[model samples]
Target chain A: MRNLIWIGFWGLFVLHQDFWYWNDATLCFGFLPIGLAWHVGFSLACSLFWMAAMKFAWPEEIEAWAAESTER
Target chain B: MEYLSFYIVVGYLALLIVLGLVSKFYSRGTSADFFVVSRTVGPVLLLLSVFGTTMTGFALVGSTGKAYTSGIGVYGLMASWAGLMHSVVFFIVGIRLWAIGKKYGYLTQCEFFRERFASPALAYLLFVILVLLVIPYLLVGVISAGKFLQGATIGMFPDLFGLPPLVLPDGTERQHPLHGSIPPEWGGLLICLVVLFYVFVGGLRGAVWANAFQTVVFMVCGVLAFYLISQRLGGFARATEMVAISPFASNRLVREGNMTQLYFLSYGLIPLSVGMFPHLFQHWLTARSAKSFRLTVIGHPVFVMIVWLPCILIGVWGAAYLGPLATGQNPNMILGRMVKELVDSQILSGLVTAGVLAAIMSSLDSQFVCLGTMFTSDIVLRLSRRTYSDEQKIMLGRIFIVAVVAVTYGLSLLLKDVALVFDLGIWCFSGFAGLFPIVFAALYWRRTTKAGAIAATLAVAVSWSILFYRDMLSDKPPGSDELTLFGVLPVTAIFLLSVLAIVVVSLITSPPSANTLRKFFPDERLSRR
Candidate 1:
């Protein structure tokens, strides 16, 4: 399940890069350019994805290691 | 207003010096305390210091100028990729390194490589390559500080210490907006001296505290500068409207001309350079615990957004408002010019100027301290093969730090109207990125050998030198030409060569001993099978 989540997040993340969509000059909401707007939204999504990764995919041993170090 | 801004910048420098002195109290008079802050930095300070060091002047002054010339694509090419990838590196490379560092009492990257490969000669080779890669990066910081100071204090000096105006080839005295604005040479020298003083006194702990404070100053002032500039351009909507109808509108949406798809995609590799940065390695070792990196990994993207979004927008907006800059004018001065034109209050502009300097100096202090640590730990002490007192180690580091600052400052003075800040910085990042494969493999792959690591390092050095020389010879600007090999960036070529050298050489050579492998990755071997 954790592997699936990482795959899904990275999949969407890489796809949204929008290199192929660079030709679109249409303005979004009548002001922001579509390319720039796409990235703005994507950046926000990345923040959530990264937070999720921290919650689920973080290495358990690292947590244990940190706990051990502090006790010393 | 100009004088006020100069005074504010001076005051900011004084504040940083005080912060440096305060950190001295925390020093335990040990090399470890001086180099890695006794390994006791909390999450918040670590997050701020790491983020602050990564941003540099390129995020502010360079990005604005890049946006003016290239368009909004600058954000996608650099920032967005960095936002996601930098965090990924922190999670993968940073935490693991911290775990290993703490367990082994390691203080520098060379020490880790030496132990992992069990080869002292390899450590010496890596040290030379790493220092060579770092000096150009240090030069970038110094050059940008000089440029920013000169631009912010324009017209504040009329006579330039009573020196006459420069005469043009036509025998006419040249006229500038302010007669005696500080030149890049003098401005760069002043910044070097100030940074040297703090790093001399405070060490890594001083750099961390200063980074946290400077991070706040730059972020708050950056946001304010963004808001004020947009408001002066008749609000965000009006500014967008202006850019939408301008001749450069196409540049805003699509990367028009020279920004090819392959080239754009290759920039994704650039942020991976963080894994190999000596300064970042130093910062990673300073973490109080492995868990301290959690905040930095999660929060880095948001910080990148906050800082980069404004600079990119301001640059895009400059297209319509400022129009085309004159020939031979420094595009790096665009951000400074926009602030002067938009802000009416002297105190506000003064604060903003200090904010820009804050961003530049935050990175400068860390680089200075990191180099000092590397020389003392990796070269001097390692080669001498004798134990030294804590005072001797600290004094040796300080002497090397002073030497580095003097050399970099002297180089900055010799440079006249060099490449744009973004262009010079990208080349430096490319060299480090090319070396990333070696470090990544050493940490993850048990088969990686000392021979392979040496081969990869040499490949990066040779390819970087050849590509850099080629770039210098061409009439095209460093990054302006749409040059690609097999439809990928020069960095991609260099990175591939490095990987090949490492993989093939390690296969032909004897693998690392089982004991060495167990020590580095005791639990991971079973999982790999």
Candidate 2:
């Protein structure tokens, strides 16, 4: 399982290089050049938003984390 | 320029004082609130706070300076984000760390390490390293402010030494000319004072909140600076075209043996440093959730893309624009050089200058707080076993902050090279990178005994010690860099070596007591096997 996680995690690391090259000016969002900052920024924002929404929406995990809260 | 200099520095100081006082309302009650802001730091502020420290004058002034001098190569600093989050085992395996830290009431990295490893000697050793390493980081902030402020305010104070001829504040032809070709002692002192004021009054919480505020200033200002500069060059396309056409841009990474090795090695080295930087992880532990941790990290690559593109642009811009100076001498002055050449508004220049100083102070103050608190929480408290009153310890923390600042400033004063200045940050971070495996394994793996932890700590210490001895005994620069051998970015080598040592020793040694294992890994033990 740890090995699987390692593979999954670091595989993403390789993918990240594509996301984070010095210049990916070839990128085309429709007819426009989204520009490097906007392209990278909006994508990251959308991904984080979706993931966060999913986490908060999960009833069981929310309840469990709530139960664990302030116990310290 | 004189009036503008006074207004910028003085006005900014007053605003910070007021902001510091206003933040005092948040500082009331329990030391926890005072130190960690009740861990109420939200995502934006948390991001900013982390950026505040992480980006610093080094990122703004030093790295840009390097970019100006070194061609597009230093932009690799930005490409470094992919590895930054890889080092974030504390966020993943570190859910266990939060539980343990809360349970034991441990604060700072060394405190947690000492208790978990159950070794006093290890704790002391770690604390000394933390103190030594933090000095360089603090200097990044101090030295950057010195350079920027001096350049920005040069003619304002021309005849202080009873000399008749005043050196005009020229944006002399380097990459970041404001970065005093000579280290500016007074500017370092002034910047140090601003950092000391808030950090002294409010401690870590104050430092972090200010960092949070400053992060935005640096990031936005950074983007704006690049955007404006690129506009002049007709944006990145023209900029990259300019660099590609320039003769100075090296194909060294492709052709040279050392550069090839370094390019790959940097991925591992930088990841380890980012993973274990005590300041970055402190933010990780304070997060609202593990999912939040994940989401926050998603921003890193994007942030890297945003932040570094400009730097590479700036570096190449410097390489192309610097003309005669490109043959020899530092190119890191590109941003400052360009600012003088391109940015003309008095208010705009002042704001930009302030933003640059904020970047330095933000990073420096937090680093100081981290170093001070680490010493107080980890070393002092460990040796005394929490013998001192909380108040006494807080005082000790403040004193440590002041002491570390003085030492780092002294070093920056002594060493005036751009390579040396930037090297300080990398050197400290590399030392901490060696500790990451032990930190993560202790958090996640139940079989990771105290013996394993002890072995890991000692292994890293001795390994680095041998490297250090080699530095002293041998004439050649250590490690494998085309520029110089043993150039202090050996993250992959260190991580693999440490991981192998810990796993082998753990396998040979008695496993951790069940109680100890339970204390760390908890609910997952049943799920594991």
Candidate 3:
């Protein structure tokens, strides 16, 4: 499950970055150009993807080491 | 208004001095306390300092200027890429480095490479390359501070210096408007001295504390500046509409004409340089625990969005409102000019100028302290066979800090019109990114050999030097297409070559000894055996 999540996260990065919107002329919400608006959404999605990584993909042993060090 | 802004900047500097002096109370009078705050920094301070250090003057002044010229593609090239990749670095590289640093009591990036590769010479090689790259990065901050101050205090000291206006041989008088104000040289010197005083007084603790305070000031004032500028050109919607309807509207949306898809994608690699930054290594080690990294990783992206969104939008708006930037005028002055023109209140403008300077100084202090720490720990202590007292260590660090500040400030003055802040910054970051593959391999791949690390460093150095020379010779204007190979950034070529060198050399050479593998990869069950 964790590996799948990591793969999904990377996939999102590659997909968002493919430059598909390079020729698009549409503006989003009457202000941002379509390409930039896509990135703003992509940025928000990346934040969540990382949050999931923190919860699921964080190295457990590092946490254990940190805990032990603080206890000392 | 210019007088008011100058006073506000003075007040901000005074406040930083106070913070620096007060930080001494927390110092236990040891080199460890001075260098890394005895590794006791909490999550909030760590997040702020790390973010502040990464932002630099490039984010505020350079991004706005580039966006003014190149349009919204500036965000795609850097800010958006940084927003994601910076957090990834914090998670993958930062946490592991913190663990190793605490375990081994490593003080600098070179110290880690030295012990891991078991080659003292590798440490020296890495130090020289890192310092060479970092000095230009330091210069970016200094030059931007000088330029911003010169722009902010325009007309404040008109004709006071009595310097005659420059004239061309063709008999045209050069427009020398800001010549009478605090020149970039003097303003740059003032910023250097203030940053040096703080880092010299309280060391890393003072730097981290100042970063936290300055980060808050800049972010708040940055948003205010954005709002005021947009309101001045009509509301946000109307301002953007004006930009959208302009003939250059396509530039506002996409990278127009001759910009390749690959070149834009290659910028994603640049933020990975954060993994190899010596200052960031020092910052990572200061974490009280690995848990301190959690907040940094989770919140950094959002924080990046908050700071960058405003600056990027304002720059795009400047395309339509400000019109073509005057020929030979520095684009870095655009943000200051926008604040001066749009904001009515002198007090507000002063506050905003103070905020911008705060952002610049926050990064400057960290770089100063990190350079000093590396010099004392990596060079003086490691190379010397004799033991030194803590007082000696502290003294060496202070002396090196002063030396680095002097060198960088001198270069800033000498090369006042050398390059735009963004252009020079991209080159510096690219050099560091070229080195990132080695650091990544060192942490994750136990087979990484000492020879492999040496080869990777050499590959980056040779490639980066050639490209830098070519860039200097070409003397292309800012926002022009950088010399690229197959439409990809020069960094892509350097990074690929570096990784290839590391992998192929490590495969041919003897792998690291079992003892070394056991030490770095302590969690591996076989390594424990």
By lDDT, the best candidate is 3
Candidate 2 CAPRI grade: incorrect
Which segments of model 1 are wrong by more than 4 Å?
Answer: A63-72, B159-174, B256-258, B416-422, B474-482, B522-529
Best model number under DockQ: 3
> Per-residue lDDT of B1-529 in model 3, one digit per residue for the tens?
4477678778888999999999988788899888999999999999999999888866777778888877777777887788888888888889989988887788999988998999988999999999988888888888878877877776677666434678989998875776666888988999999999988989999999999989998898889899888788888778888887788543665665525577788889999999988998999999998888988988888888888888888888877777777788877777877876777667777877788888889888989999999888887887789998999899999999999999999888888887644477878889999999999999999889999999999999999888877775657768865677778888998999999999999999999987788777747633355
Candidate 2: tens digits of C-alpha lDDT, residues B205-294: 777778767766667777888777777777666655665556664221111321233454454455455556776656555545444444
Each model's lDDT: 0.83, 0.59, 0.84
DockQ of each: 0.46, 0.17, 0.48
Clashes of each: 1, 16, 0
Q: Give the higher-TM-score candidate: 1 or 2.
A: 1
> Candidate 3, B352: how far from true, in Å?
3.0
Q: How far is candidate 2 from the true structure (C-alpha RMSD, Å)?
A: 5.5
Scored against the true structure, residue B129 in model 1 reaches a CA lDDT of 82
lDDT comparison, 2 vs 3, better candidate: 3
Instruction: Provide candidate 3's TM-score on chain A.
Output: 0.76
Query: Which structure is stronger by TM-score: 1 or 3?
Result: 3
Task: For each candidate, give its TM-score against the true structure.
Answer: 0.94, 0.81, 0.94
